[model samples]
Target: MAAESGKIDPMHQFLVEPLFGQHLVVGGYDISFTNSALWMVLTLGVLWVFMLGGMKRELVPGRWQAAVESLTGFVGNMMDANIGPKGKAFTPYVFSLFMFILFANILGMLPIGVVGLHAFTVTSHLTVTGVLAVLSFSIVLIVGFAKHKLHFFSLFVPHGTPVVMIPLIFLVELLSFLVRPFSLGLRLFVAMTAGHILLKVLAGFVINGLNAGPGIAAIVSIPSFVLMIGITLLELLVCAIQAYVFALLTSLYLNDAINLH
Candidate 1:
């Protein structure tokens, strides 16, 4: 069935087809408004409004304020649970990561067709996720260095280990640290890409089945349509889960830096 419609390009949803290209004699980069940039800006806009609106603290909290408070508390509690008392200082960083991803995922799920444009899945692209992972990794490294000074290198050398095994342990530890960003970024990119592909495939099935025949087509299409709706809801939950998982892992990494545990 998938072959009948031709092989669908999973990357098509992430392609940032440039609206225009800029030329410069010395050097230049693409300046055209791409779908990725569009969705990113939209996500930022939503985040700004949600956060700002909620900060206007009132004696009786409004819906927006309550929502913001809930998010804040959620992150705060997560940090405390994961990193103990030392985790309090890391709240801002974790909160920002969570909110950015949450907003991006939710914005992508919106009915963007009303604007006469296709919805772009920014999170599905490895470049974007890799950049975010790198940013988190940098934070972990910098904070560890600043807080622990040169002793931060001890992270790669376990304590209470036999001297003979120290070299092998260090090698394993170093590789694990190096792969943090790749793992974090790939997990998110793969999940988003796979989910979007499934959604597109199911949607195609519904359309093709409807065109095949009135009776048989309708029967098959009904289940496909139902599955599509179910997947849509599941996608929403996945979006939140991915965001939370990213933030949770980030916090855990930071905890290792701060507490050395």
Candidate 2:
């Protein structure tokens, strides 16, 4: 819906616009550098610097090295506990997943301006999250089939089902399995999008209130500003929790595929 007069358009923030003045078209398709792409690349670059720059040989680690080491150990221990000893073999992949999502989430919180607009969050897009979720599911599917061959089909069959109910049970399980990617992607997309919308609305209220007559604006702005601050802090916590949840769910799915449970 278009924004009505006198109200802020919260959804406008999610619109993807070309970074360059002129849009780039190639082979009848638009292929322009966008705010979303820019932020994604920035996040990747930050990760590269953090991880590689931390590889110093000093016995007494500096702040940067210490932070990198701590993050490495945190993800490493998460895999060890969640996926057990075999998880170490997949540590690189799982750690990359965790870091990528973590960085993307944190980067979205930045106030940096980009191409006349504020930062664009790649994870705020359903397509981006959907791709990540599908990629994780694909890894699980490939690993499961490689390890168990035709027996991987048994994943949808309950171990001790009565003969007559096998077909019904299989259908239900298969449906659940098929929806995993959608569910995983939707969870992150919805959480981030909703939080941003709520923040925008509260911010709008504060702005609108302050623009009124001085005495009235002062009175109204106080509560709105306070509420906005509370939401901002809550969002900070949500950012970390969502990233951990995505990584944790991926690991759990991997475990199910490997152990066929």
Runs of candidate 1 exceeding 4 Å displacement = 1-10, 20-26, 114-116
Residue 145, model 2: Cα distance from true site in angstroms:
0.5
Global CA lDDT computed for model 2: 0.85
lDDT of each: 0.85, 0.85
TM-score of 1: 0.90
lDDT of 2 by residue, 72-185 (tens): 888888888877887887778878888888898888877553234486678889999999999999999999999999899899997999999999999999999999999999
- What is the lDDT for 31 in model 1? 56
Model 1 poorest 10 in a row by lDDT: 1-10
Kindly report which residue stretches of model 2 are placed more than 4 angstroms away from their true locations once superposed: 1-6, 113-117
Candidate 1 lDDT, 150-225, residue by residue in tens:
9887898888989999999989998999999999999998988898888878766677677778885678878988
Find the number of clashing residue pairs for candidate 1.
Answer: 0
Q: What is the lDDT of residue 197 in candidate 1?
A: 83
Q: Give TM per candidate.
A: 0.90, 0.92
For candidate 2, the TM-score is 0.92
